[model samples]
Target: MTNVTYKYATVLVAIQNLRNEGYNVDFNLEENCLICGDNKYTIDDFEIEQVYRYEGESNPSDEATVYGIASKDGLKGILVTAYGAYTDSMSTAMLRKLALKND
Candidate 1:
């Protein structure tokens, strides 16, 4: 994947920009999949297209990441997740998949 950085001042701005770019869905991270409405997308069903990370100035708890995701079937969305201290728990495959672009 190509490396790209967006200059959105905050996580909210990044989300809005991605929405305007056609990523209309909102994906929730699951233990081994991503949930969008009633649909559950496994690791093999999607790819991370872009990642935007925000770090807090005073506290680590404010750290968060916004991911631009696209499924094989053409569905596009964004996943907003906390990093650092309050990270979510997930399967190894799910962690690896997300970590690929996060790093």
Candidate 2:
């Protein structure tokens, strides 16, 4: 597994460590996929290789998650998001695919 093996004290540390290990690109969620700059990848075209979730001891606002995403065409990146009550504003088909992946 290419997952980060050590426990990072914070989200920032985890991101920096992951980047140092080559998960350099940053991804944004799209309607039916993930996008990094002009490049896009559909649900079936990319995989979430690893996931890391962090929560603050005193504040829910500090919740965050990081996803290691890799595309079939060889692009590698990370997607950072808020943890609780977050919603994916994508089509039903795309949403279903992502949901199944989480399970």
Candidate 3:
């Protein structure tokens, strides 16, 4: 079993890393990235961490890895993205309330 709640700090660091890279990214650890295989990260995991999206006419077939993050409603939600597929538009108000509650 994956330790979901235990990786709070690690999840935050991953998001910060993406942000520092100039990509509009967020965190969603609820997403299971190991379904493909033991110790194997699903495409969603990479997408969430790397913030990737599909190009041309074809859309992304891979679902995103979901992580726990402070959402726009002052609640935590599973973050998802596809490079350019889904960029969350979180409200600053909700942002301020979350990310530090449990930490």
Error (Å) of candidate 3 at residue 96 is 33
Which pairs clash inside model 1? none
- Tens digits of per-residue lDDT, candidate 1, 5-101, equal 6578999999999999999999997667999999999999998888887888998788888889999888999998886422356877788777634
Best by lDDT: 1
Q: What does candidate 3 score on TM?
A: 0.21
Q: What value does the lDDT take at residue 84 in candidate 3?
A: 28
Candidate 3 — number of clashing residue pairs?
Answer: 14
lDDT, candidate 3, 37-90, per-residue tens: 133333322321222222234645443333433323232223544442332443
Per-residue lDDT, model 2, residue 58, is 95
Best by TM-score: 1
Error of 3 at 13 (Å): 0.2
Q: Listing every candidate in turn, what is its Cα RMSD in Å to the true structure after a full C-alpha superposition?
A: 2.2, 3.3, 14.5
Candidate 2 clash figure, as a count: 0
**Candidates sorted by TM-score, descending order?**
1, 2, 3
- Model 2 C-alpha lDDT versus the unseen true structure: 0.72
